[model samples]
Target: MDLIHRRSNSSSTGRSNTYDQLRSSPYADVIYDTTSGGEYLMKLQIGTPPVEFEALIDTGSSVIWTQCLPCLNCYDQRNPIFDPSKSSTYQDLRCNNKADHSCVYDLVYGDQSYSIGSFATETVTIKSTSGQSYVMPETIIGCSHNSSMLGRSFSGMVGLNLGRSSLVSQMGKHMQGAISYCFSPEGTSKIHFGSNAIVSGEGTVSTTMFMKKENHVFYYLNLDRLDAVSVEETRIETLGTPFHAVDGNIIIDSGTTFTYLPASYYSLVREAVEKVVTAERVTYQDDDSLCYKTDTMDIFPVITMHFSGGADLVLGKNNTYMDYGEGAICLIIICGPAAPNFGEAIFGNIAQNNFLVGYDLSSRLVSFKPTDCGVTQDIPIDDNSISAASLFQFNIKFVLFVFVLSLIRL
Candidate 1:
């Protein structure tokens, strides 16, 4: 997932208020909240001072990058610099693309304010309340020169979400088995770093949207009000495109800002949205995301994507449209920032806000359900650490299969 939606990084406007529910959970300790909120406060060490500010929890962005003191392009910062010099365990792995790193990535957001120096290998630690600390390895991070966007004045981002170079994937190498986590927005959000032991919870989570094909990533789609809107919304008014894509895989990233679609499909969607929204209202257009204006009446009728099993997902007015400004919204929308083959679509935090995504590292599964809040929770599936059986109907299906097979054989 590339840049989902960027507003050409202007110098600065009015400072916005940031809110984050950051807490520790037994399953995943680093479940930090990166909502529209600016930043959060956390003690680097048990005795260390707690620093908080705005941070973009990007599902699209894999690396957890942050601004430092020496950055020339650094933007409005409110907190003290993270003095890497002070920490005894601090060491810049210095593994850049120049060295034995995978891909040399030097990216600048559309704003061109913050330029990131991509590098692999870094040391990460948590300042535990009991004065104890644990370190995780194989995590990649970003060094930012500048930071100025919706949120402001922040040290850096705490990214352990899913993506190609995410800390989860990198740490998985050393951790051995898997990493299970749930982000509790109610001051209970914590990262369950390094182990599946922490992901235990009561209740069985279910869904057919989870796939363990490649590295097991979470994926879900709800077209707002597919049920109500489909009455006159689209030809195929449904939820997810039935039968999972055998062609291209999908990833549910919390860091990304917007969604991406194939060129042809995007065009069709634009046309569908255009049918309801006139051209005059939704005129602004660009590369990353489609910009549109909405009138009082055009509050988002409906946008449905027909899926298998005849199950139609009905996205409400909110999920159906994007908010651009006051009394107006994006009519026909398309969010594809740095998307590959135009096929790789990203369901960024804004969209993910609608669902509670549970990631089971040990089982290699991601489950999603209707959630009003942005914080993804562990759906009370069964008394199991990982929501495996709940995500995939495999366990239930297998039991029935065995029973029927036994009956037939008998």
Candidate 2:
């Protein structure tokens, strides 16, 4: 399973708005690649005949969706729009009366991108590198007839969060509530589910994971302290005026490009790094990133993040900073909006590079292990691991009833 990164093609104005929206909302559903700060895409097949397409893998959203045919208004995509009418296994889940029974969904992103479509069920298939195929039937999906402001690289999104409609939750007991992924700086990466997702070996550390009552679409972790090696150790609670150690203080998101801290705390981190590095300070007018005129990241100090349960993640220059232009490197961590408006911090994917990160939802734990993601061993799968009879049985009528009922309640 190789993940594809999409580069940014938007103008400077659009890029600025994307950054501002991400900083203000912790739950933005934008897909990020390394260049454009978007997300990783996975190849999958939808419908009975199997229409293969690449979809954005997001941890901040729920509901699997793709642009469908007869598009009222849609953005250009690399692949052709999916035609539900041509699929033999597609089911509309129409009500008895059939006059106005279509289940419609309107999903809006923080950057004002949106998808509007009807809810339906179809067969989904995922093929592993070893040529083993995992077929899931009656998978709920949104057939987006109207959409806007989406990139052309990927056709749709695959939600991997803790929400009920997420792919992980819909898989039920088969996946055992587990998932793992390894991200490389460049080239392809891998993501696994079920038993193959377990992370265990030397240098592996586990930490507690929290799920908010109001928001279950994000993975939360607590940051106890941070130490700029050979510089200074600052407790998170003591850095900001009224900051305190709370469970799930920071969210670990794979769709975001940079790590974000509160404005007050980020100022302290900036000052500490300025004193340690000898590189000439440069202003990055594009965004609120700290840039330095240096040829190499060797001048930057190693940053250690001490999380709850004694999980100390040691980040090198590659994980802490990135190349901005010809002769300048900028810190990947930036200052987010001020407190009250945006209080939660973000642990973006840049810091997770070169590490195998595993999440065990049943155990409520997340594990991290340092590994060269670019050249990692592949997990072998048994040909008979999953059978057609073992697939979860779901009632389409019942699902439509509940979905329509929820809309009525709202």
Candidate 3:
């Protein structure tokens, strides 16, 4: 099989200051994120009596975990658990040692935990507009015995491995084209699989190539023009950084709802942002991230993000800070675990709101442009890459570099 290769900018230290995480996905009728602000959903089935439920489509994870009947520790579950004993088609994919990412394991979520198992082959059915039935075979699905509110209401996760294994792929065995992701943040959405799989309305958008490696996704930013005037002390620079070549490894994460930067770039951003803001009244939420009181910040620094295809992408206030249940977002600076390491940033959901995002795996490219939602921005349109006539199926490959190690932890 032939593949598209991407280049990277190197540093004198030779240490890779990049963050890329990969997960695997496989299921039937499994539509990845296909809604605006991503309110995508999928149909799910439980065992024995065969319980069917509608679930959210998640690609930021690997295990296709779900909640099932006999759920020992399920709590405040808004939905019914799957009755595995009643389902005649349920089969287990012993989670002990399996490469299909079907090995069962125990997972712990905030204030809740559970046992997870896998299914190697299962029947997944999806419907088209005319009620057309499309099914997936031998799908790897995860079952959560000890469940919680987070697992019960949702159907299951669809991991997006590097061009392989996904709920969309399993269903694609019976569909028309590649899967695309369309997400927005209300924590409620649907994920579509196959042709016209991932869709949104507005048609005015552009395209560019993405930088990927191994099983990870890397993205590019035209840093040379990241700022209109002086951002901080030094001129925003990416003269020599990983994935800085005309083309290299850059990643966009649906799961990681924040922007991450390499150590050096992180430092520069912090230093520069600090120079503009005063030390007093500066709030410290976490060690890795930071922001000053918006009122105290100096003249709003114009951050100019240069995209590959000559697109000028910009971030609204929400992109820099999260509400954290508060009414306002942090400004002047946002923090990731990297604090100030390299010179790269990982784009997260808050930053991607309403923007038309396109990732073309077939051509190894990713692109983004502005959008003016009824309440979001005043901008005109939000469209992205690919063509309906050509059937664009860009296989997204994720490569997880390290645990909280080199990545900018939000």
TM-scores for every candidate against the unseen true structure: 0.56, 0.78, 0.60
- Per candidate, the number of residue pairs that clash is 49, 7, 67
TM-score-best of 1 and 2:
2
Query: Residues 137-250, candidate 1, lDDT per residue (tens digit)?
Result: 434566555455445544565455456666455544444323333333444343343332233333323323444454443343323224312424466322353312532234
Each model's Cα RMSD: 15.7, 17.5, 18.0
What is the C-alpha lDDT profile of model 3 across 1-410, one tens digit per residue? 42221111234324331210001121233222333223344566534344566554444344555666666665444456666666677777665455654555564422243345444456555443222233344566767666544323454444443333555444443333234443444333333333333334554333354444543423333333333113433456566544244543334555444566655556666676667655443345553445444442234354444555645555655455444322222543443443221323555555666565554444544455455422322211113222333232323212233434456764
Better of 1 and 2 by lDDT: 2
lDDT top scorer: 2
TM-score of candidate 2 to 2 decimals: 0.78
Candidate with best TM-score: 2
Q: Which is the better candidate, 2 or 3, if ranked by lDDT?
A: 2
Residue 296 alpha-carbon offset, candidate 2, angstroms: 1.1
Tell me the whole-model lDDT of each prediction, alpha carbons only.
Answer: 0.43, 0.71, 0.45
TM-score of candidate 1 to 2 decimals = 0.56
Candidate 3 wrong stretches, greater than 4 Å: 1-57, 72-76, 94-115, 146-155, 161-163, 173-177, 185-191, 197-213, 216-235, 241-247, 275-280, 284-288, 294-304, 324-328, 331-345, 372-410
Estimate the lDDT of model 3: 0.45
Task: For candidate 3, report its TM-score.
Answer: 0.60
Model 2 scores a C-alpha lDDT of 0.71
